[model samples]
Target: MRNGFAKTDDLIKMFNVSPGTITNMIKQLKTEGLVIHQPYKDVKLTEKGREIAIQAVRRRRIVE
Candidate 1:
C-alpha cells in the first residue's frame, strides 16, 4: 500500500469494503490534499500523504 499507486478495485479486494466506502474515503483524502484520485484510475499519495504514512508506520513499530 506504499511506494506506488493502487487501483480502487485492488483496495476493495484488500479491505473488503464497499465501493461507496472507498469512494467517500478517497474524496476525503482528496480534500485533505493527501491523495490524487480519479474515477476508473489508480490512486496515488501526495508527498504530504507519504510522509504521514511513514510517520504512522514508525509509530506503529514503536507501539509494537
Candidate 2:
C-alpha cells in the first residue's frame, strides 16, 4: 500500500529495484484490497493496509 500511496521512486532507488518490481507488488497489494489507487493520484492504503503498516512499524521499532 505504501508503495502505491507514497513516493516510491526514492525507495526504488534505495533498493535498486526495477520499476516493474514495484509496480507488480503494488498491483498485488491492490488486488488483495489492501490498497486503493485513485486515478492520477498517490496510492492510499485501505483500512487493512493501515493496520498492517502500523503493526509493521511497531515490530520494526521493537526490533531496533
Candidate 3:
C-alpha cells in the first residue's frame, strides 16, 4: 500500500491465498523493510516497497 493501507483479508481475497501464507509473506516483507504490519490492522508499504513494486510492474510490462 502506497497511498492507502491493505488488510490481510483484502489481500487474501484478491490473491486467493491462505491467511497463514499471506501472514508469512508480510512478515518477510517487513523484515526486508519493504512493508510495515501491525497486529489487527492494515499493512502499509514503505517508499522502498513502492519503488520495488513499480520496478516489478515495469519488468512485467516489458516481458509481456
Candidate 4:
C-alpha cells in the first residue's frame, strides 16, 4: 500500500480544480489543523483529518 502523501499537483488534477483553488483549499485545511502543506511538496493529513476521513468512509459504508 502507498503510505505517502499525494503531491499538490496530483490533488489538483484529482479534484479537477485550478491551482489557485487547490491553494485556497489547502490553506483552509491548514487553518483547521486538518492538514499540513508546504509549497512544492505533498499535502499530508493530520491525525484529526485522518480520523475524520476514516469515519466518513465508515459511515458511507454503513449507510450503503
Candidate 5:
C-alpha cells in the first residue's frame, strides 16, 4: 500500500523483487482480505491493510 495502490509491475520495479514473488505476496494479501485488486488497475488496500500499514510505519519510526 505504500505505493498508493501499486500495480504488480510497479511493485516489482520499486522493490526489485521477482514477479513470481510479488504474485505470491499479492495472493496471500488478497486471501487475508488485506488487499483488493480491480480489473486492469492497481492493487488497493482494504481498511485492515491501511491500518496495518500505518501501524507498521509508526513502528518503524519508533525503532529507528
Candidate 6:
C-alpha cells in the first residue's frame, strides 16, 4: 500500500471480509513475525513480510 501500513478497518474494507477474519489474519501474521500490529493502530509489514510481498508481486507479473 502507499502508506506501508494498513489499519484493521481498511483491511476489512479492502478485502471485503469480516472484522473477525482480519483479526484472525493479523494474529497469524503476528505469530509468524511477518507483521507488527499496534493495538488500535495500523499493521506494518516486517522486512521478511515485505520481501515475501515483493516476491509474490514479481511472481504474479511473470505468471500473468
TM-score of each: 0.90, 0.71, 0.91, 0.86, 0.85, 0.91
Ranking by lDDT: 1, 6, 3, 4, 5, 2
Candidate 2 residue-wise lDDT, 3-42, digit = tens: 5456557546767899788778778989999987653456
Per-residue lDDT over 1-64 for candidate 5, one digit per residue giving the tens place of the 0 to 100 score: 4566787788889889998898888889999999998545688889999999999999999999
Error of 6 at 30 (Å): 0.6
State the lDDT of candidate 3 residue by residue for 1-64, as single tens digits.
3356998899999899999999999999999999989978899889999899999999999999
Per-residue lDDT for 1-64 in model 6, tens only?
5489888898999999999999999999999999999778899999999999899999999999
Error of 2 at 20 (Å): 0.6
lDDT, model 4:
0.88
Looking at candidate 2, what is the lDDT of residue 24?
Answer: 80
What RMSD, rounded to one decimal, does every model reach? 1.7, 3.6, 1.6, 1.7, 2.4, 1.2
Residue pair clashes in candidate 3: none
Per-residue lDDT of model 4, residues 1-64, tens digit only:
1465878888888899999999999999999999988988788899998999899999999999
Task: Name model 5 segments beyond 4 Å from true.
Answer: 1-3, 38-40
Better of 1 and 3 by lDDT: 1
- Residue 21 deviation, candidate 3, in Å? 0.4
Give one digit per residue, the lDDT tens place, for model 1 in 15-59: 899999999999999999999888888999999998998999999
Error of 1 at 48 (Å): 0.4
- What overall lDDT goes with each candidate model? 0.92, 0.76, 0.91, 0.88, 0.86, 0.92
TM-score of 4: 0.86
Model 6 gets an lDDT of 0.92
